[model samples]
Target: MQQSSGWRGSADIWLQAAYENLIESGVDAVRIQPLAKQLKLSRTSFYWFFKDREELLSALLAQWREKNTGNLVKQAERYGESIIESVLNVFDCWLDQDLFDTHFEFAVRSWALQSNDVKAQISEADEIRLAALRSMFLRFGFEGEAADVRARTVYLTQIGYISMKSREDLAIRMKRIPEYVRIFTGKSPEQRDLLRFYARHNYTQEPYEK
Candidate 1:
């Protein structure tokens, strides 16, 4: 058996390299040999922590789901004050160019299309995120069906922003989010202004179009 210390170190290196490669290229571009080469390790080192390419890929996808998607939803739940803010934060999190990028979003979406396990994992994450947003909307005063619609709209906006590649375009798109929120929540100008101020200062601009 491999020493515990050596085993963990190798696993960490492998995951870090794999995630970088996935973000730079795409899921299909991630191969065991290339990842091992990037880490200056032999293929045997990869097998020490992961049984094969499939296992490594599975772990990589799981990590992406957990860190990129799951953690955001969890944090929003913890920090958000109003239902509107909580729901808006979900979009804000996805739009964060520093934390999230077009390539990373594409990697997840592409993996979902190619792998059943990946699709299920992403679907589960989406469900949780959407549910949390929906609940936040309800708490902020939106009714049953309307909250659901607003939650879906928020999800769509995130996806839309991810499709664009320019920072300037992204900012333009983000500027419109407040309007959508106002329409969904029926907030007056004062309420809309307050929300916009909070969103602008608190969150990163949406990915693409700065």
Candidate 2:
């Protein structure tokens, strides 16, 4: 397909539109025509970037894998002074959407419910994420089963929050982080560690119950 009057939609633009549709409605709504209308571009413009809708959908999945899964693994591997701090590093994903897009993750998991190939991809992603979390625990001297269980505890709790679309006040969640870190790593985060975590999220006020 040729560009309309030399104005062609970029791949990122189209993919981002498709992503909005998927997260807002579902994957079925991510058609070329609707996206073209949404972008005020010609439907043929989509083809300039993608061969078909399947290619666009594949691109969405690839972006999800890179953004969500890739960032999660990187956070798990981030340097920290202790296991508690390490777990807090991974917690950045929960607070920051740029690190882990929970809504997109939920939408992809929902899409997987009806597509075997997508389901397989989601399963692979789960294992990869779990392995990274487990490795983080092992680096801190946790035993195999202990590391696996702790990793599951951390990962699944966040997934549950996404799946349930649970909403909480940000300050309240920040207050709970210290205990959550203790429960996940079997060690309470130091006052300095909590301060660092708070500063990272720009929670300027004190972040604990009196």
Query: What are the C-alpha RMSDs, in order, of all predicted structures?
Result: 4.9, 2.1
Every model's TM-score = 0.76, 0.95
List, residue by residue over 21-58, the lDDT tens digit for candidate 2.
Answer: 99999999999998999999999878888899998999
Q: For residues 1-210, could you state the per-residue lDDT of candidate 1 as single tens digits?
A: 232335335776777788888878878778988876777677777777878888878788767766667666664565556654555655556556454445666678777787887778878877877887677777777889998988777776666655564355555655666666566566522455445645664636533221
| lDDT of model number 1 | 0.66
Whole-model Cα lDDT per candidate?
A: 0.66, 0.92
**Clash-forming residue pairs, model 1:** 166-208, 166-209, 167-208, 167-209, 167-210, 168-209, 168-210, 169-209, 170-209
Model 2 RMSD, rounded to 1 decimal: 2.1
Give each model's clash number: 9, 0
Worst lDDT run of 10 residues, candidate 1, spans 201-210
